[model samples]
Target: MTGEPEGPDFDVPVGLFEDIEDLKAKLARLTAQVEALTGGDGAEPGEASADEGEAAGGEAAADDAEEEEWQYPPFILLLDPPEYDDELRALIEWVEGVLVPGYLAEPSADARWCHLWWEHPVAIARLHAVWLAWQELTDPASCGYTGPSVWHRDHMDPALRELRGSTGPFAGCVKGEHQIDHRMPGLVPSAWTHAED
Candidate 1:
């Protein structure tokens, strides 16, 4: 009967099943490696990756949301002239009674007051006027015999001498030249009396 081995029966594809099994085993190994790397400490592998991504995103958002830095302005405190002794005293009283208390109670109020004092010319002028009024009140004899001179030359002369010794071009000028022009020479006027027009 035709016994030539029929050419080795070539119907099935060569190595097809072995290739499929090999690929399945490789996939399983890869999955196991991923699980080992990510799945520890009771958390799923995917959850850790998600959490890390969220954290990175939050940091980026925070960086983007940063604000500009702030800066402070410069300032100075001005003192009244000695001639305005009455006004200075009044100012000290006002500061002690109203300003210091307000500032202590609310820092923002002090800041606002400073801003107003710097920005408003009228406020500065008002302060100057107060000082002028005080100076006039403290030494009523400044305008000569036109009004009663309550200020004593004995006391004022020494003050003038002391002022002359002070350092500056205008120091001695107050008593040496200016005093002669502004001294009170008659009876002392009442506190309420206004100078003759």
Candidate 2:
């Protein structure tokens, strides 16, 4: 054989990622590699293969119904409003009982609890993603890979960085710029005060 490299793009230049598309392509490749190694599946119930489909189609009709009952964007926070659904009651209980008092309420954290943010749709969505990431990286029953290091690297860091970032949902609310009213804020969004002028 002649003196030549064996694989595709064997002569790729060092600065190939200087292009936006090339950078995106490289990122996609990296993400795929990580997913392959870590067993990360896509985000929907029906996103699995035919063999997996048969499993979800089993005697878990109630489970399927629950999944189908979910709203457009499946943020756990949205389950709290309208004040009647039993699922909402449970979600609120879990957040208050576990998520908030344990993690979000910490003074050492870069994140400060925003009781009124659940009212904002965008905040609801972002925080829901964080919560999902928490479930993925923490719950011992989950099948995929997990660890504090992995959680911080893949989930916790990005979620907190975005949610508690300078221009995030708490943009003006974190500092003294716009203050949350201290008039007895509680678990419910309505109980919390807004940053209204």
Number of the top lDDT candidate: 2
Give the alpha carbon lDDT tens digit for every residue of 68-179 in model 1: 1111111112444553455455655654564446432322211222312322233334444433333454553335452323332333323323322343122212211221
Highest TM-score model number: 2
In model 2, the Cα lDDT at residue 44 comes to 45
lDDT of each: 0.37, 0.51
- Would you list the clashing residue pairs of candidate 2? none
For model 2, the superposed segments whose C-alpha errors exceed 4 Å read 1-91, 105-112, 144-149, 174-197
Q: How accurate locally is residue 171 in candidate 2, as Cα lDDT from 0 to 100?
A: 51
lDDT (10s digit) by residue, model 2, range 116-187: 665544555665565556666676534345554676677656766776665566654543333333222463
Q: Candidate 1, clashing residue pairs?
A: none
What TM-scores do the predictions have?
0.17, 0.41
TM-score for candidate 1: 0.17
Q: In the order shown, what is each candidate's alpha-carbon RMSD?
A: 34.4, 14.6
